[model samples]
Target chain A: MKLLSNSKIWAVAVIMLSGLVYIGSCTRDNDLIVPVKLTQPFAPNRGTNIHLPGTMTVGDPTQWKMDKAHSSVLWSSNYIGTAGLLTGRFNQFGMHDVAAAEMLNYVATGQPLLDNSWAFNEANPAQTFFSGYVQINQSNTGEPGRDGGCNISGMGTTPIVAGTQNLTVTNLAKIKSTKVEFDASSNGYIVTFDLTWQGKLAAPLTKSIVGKLNYITMTTIATATPYKVFGLQLKFQFNCRDFGITSTSIADKIDIECNMNFNNK
Target chain B: MPDSFFAYAEWVELETFFAGYLLVYAIIYLVALNRPATGFVKTRLLPNLPLAYAFAGTLYLGLQLKNAYPDYTIEHLTAGVQLPYLRIWGLISILFWIPLLQKKPVFSLLHSLVFFFLLMKSLFLQLFTSSPGNDMARNNMKIYSISIFLNLGALILVTIISLLIARFNTQKRSTGI
Candidate 1:
């Protein structure tokens, strides 16, 4: 009774609560997903020097620069045993000017090559190559708590800090095209790229991802600048197990869709 | 188990747990109001349960917020520069715990002022800082409004109960009962 006086109740509560907090803090954090090696670096400010296919013949070649605001990289996966899918977007990502790289390859080898393959349909307007990275920390699903959990499970883990930009270089899902061919059977292009991500083990995991470039069009954004936009849509899927994400709620296969708009302002 | 309890439905689950906990606390406090402090367990241990629960909940919320936003700070919180998810509920959890530590009626009434400020903060941020398109903001407005009011009610109820306890003790002393 003496020790447990009314005034001493707060002290007792403090000690007990501190114990619970200490136990919780003792749990280990998940490993962080880091990129192995990137062949090309992301240059957000640089503009593409290569002309739009077929536009070179029309004498008004459009040099494209990525319009960051109009572009989005979205991901979705079906819930286990459910009809609905969980959708999210990578808030921060940038595209590599694959066209410029292609032009450089043509200059160097006197052969138009893409991802070490011959660009047979380089003149096709629908033909385009993609190279980019999605920042792991910027994965936003609108819900912050879910975003934290998803990031931990899907992209390994990242420490939550005060700033918006965190581990910008290390925590990334990088991709570069390995092969690109215009499909004569359909009004689209088939793109195969190398996806490098953090694996379940210590070493990084690199896998080939095949996707379809189903939509490519030239449009104008009716803004003050009246920007000429070259829009590209790419869709692909990869198994989450490849990255060691074992969350039961998330389906094994994740569908990724990117709507990127490049502008010539 | 902790993850399931706190991270079940994200925002919804957290708010539900808090509201439910407060309701339970109010009921238990009311039931135990007139009971004689027969022993150390009843007088000392039982009274501290609210503080223990408050600390546990606050720690959990802090960890949850930290996991969600790593770089969050008191400055960022006050600036309203970041998402409202960390701002409204995190502060509420923190402020609610402070009054639970004090036993005096006057000290507990101080929470009324804290709640008032928090209420203003919620209304200002929800109406002004959060963008209209933000779903979290819309949900926050609804959750914060109800929870803050409930907290105020609980504060008032606790104060009244404290006064009753004082009067009860005075009557017993005077009558030598």
Candidate 2:
């Protein structure tokens, strides 16, 4: 009881000390909790009619362009046990809104088209498209030290010079996808890209790592903006070997998510 | 991670969690040392210390929950902040746990603090932070947060119970009951 037998005097003193430590915090509305999904795989629903775009309906695929300022690409990966979650993003890449006639029609009609597919202009359903190339070196993992680590060791020269990190990674600089297509199995769009990882980096002991960056992201919205627009999300998974990363400390697999916003270009 | 790197470095985050847990107790024990070692010190104060730490741990965990996200940890806030001590904190805390062997009220207070510290600043921070990233996760986090607070409040009540028991013993011994 004597711990507080000095209660009155200690109360004043303890309060003073508490004040020095706590100093108090002000409640503000500044923090934004960005959402992300890990280990998410994409598989569109099936049994529905598949619409493969024709050159005429889709327009000049080679003529498409992405407005850099309007879109963003964020990626996330994991550590082995609990280095916590690791995330990085491309500061520069190519991505733009889907300008498909069906999607635009949906925006105009305020309704999605039938057969579980986007209701495009019936005459040219494949006329809608969204595509671009994602640069490698442009990936800023948020941390300079981490970015440096990835560039110097993890990614090797691909982000810098493709052949330097993994001689086999001939397309070292980017992961390019042509168009986003609706998949019946997963009820999502399937866009594919190839990542040339360091399958085998030059070494003293010969590390056996075969690397390749590959993914199919299911896009979503964080919040909605007018024109049926807002930020887009792409979530998927990959193996560490894809980047020629082979170590027990390095996890076997990692989940990735990308967030982007696009406007009509 | 590669064969050349120590895998332990990735998971055992001493800088944030382990060291943070140890510091919660060290701070309380050091504070108690400055005061007179009354009978209440062993019974009431010691247990109370850990409880206080619990409060600290929770707040810290809640605030630093952002670090669980790689984007947040690497987001250039403490540009030069690197604590080698965190790596060694686990080893140091082994010694720190020695003081906890004796103090009950102090232990409760200190133990709670460690719990809170680990949750907010250590591995638990990531679990708790990421738990709320989605609608389902957010719902689960609500239950989790409620339980954490409830447990903390329970510890506070236990400290009070210890205080009453210590007072009853003091009264009995004084009157030769």
Top candidate by TM-score: 1
Residue A65 CA error for candidate 1 (Å)? 1.3
Off by over 4 Å in 2: A1-65, A81-83, A95-132, A158-187, A190-232, A247-250, B1-177
* TM-score, predicted candidate 1 vs. hidden true structure: 0.39
Candidate with the greatest lDDT versus the true structure: 1
Give native contacts recovered, as a fraction, per prediction. 0.00, 0.00
* DockQ of prediction 2: 0.02
Q: Which stretches of candidate 1 lie over 4 Å from their true place?
A: A1-62, A97-128, A160-164, A167-170, A220-226, B1-177
Q: Write the per-residue lDDT of candidate 2 for residues A180-202, one digit (tens) a residue.
A: 55543444455554433343344
**lDDT per residue (tens digit) for residues B1-177 in model 1:** 012423324444344324323333333344455466675334643454444444434654665567658666776544532325533554454544566453532232232234333433443443444233444434444554455344444444554565588889999999999
Residue A131's lDDT within candidate 2 is: 34
Per-prediction TM-score, please? 0.39, 0.29
Per-residue lDDT tens digits for candidate 1, residues A28-146, read 23234566786665432322323343222222325455556788999998887265998889876666423322221112211122112111233443344557766676788898888
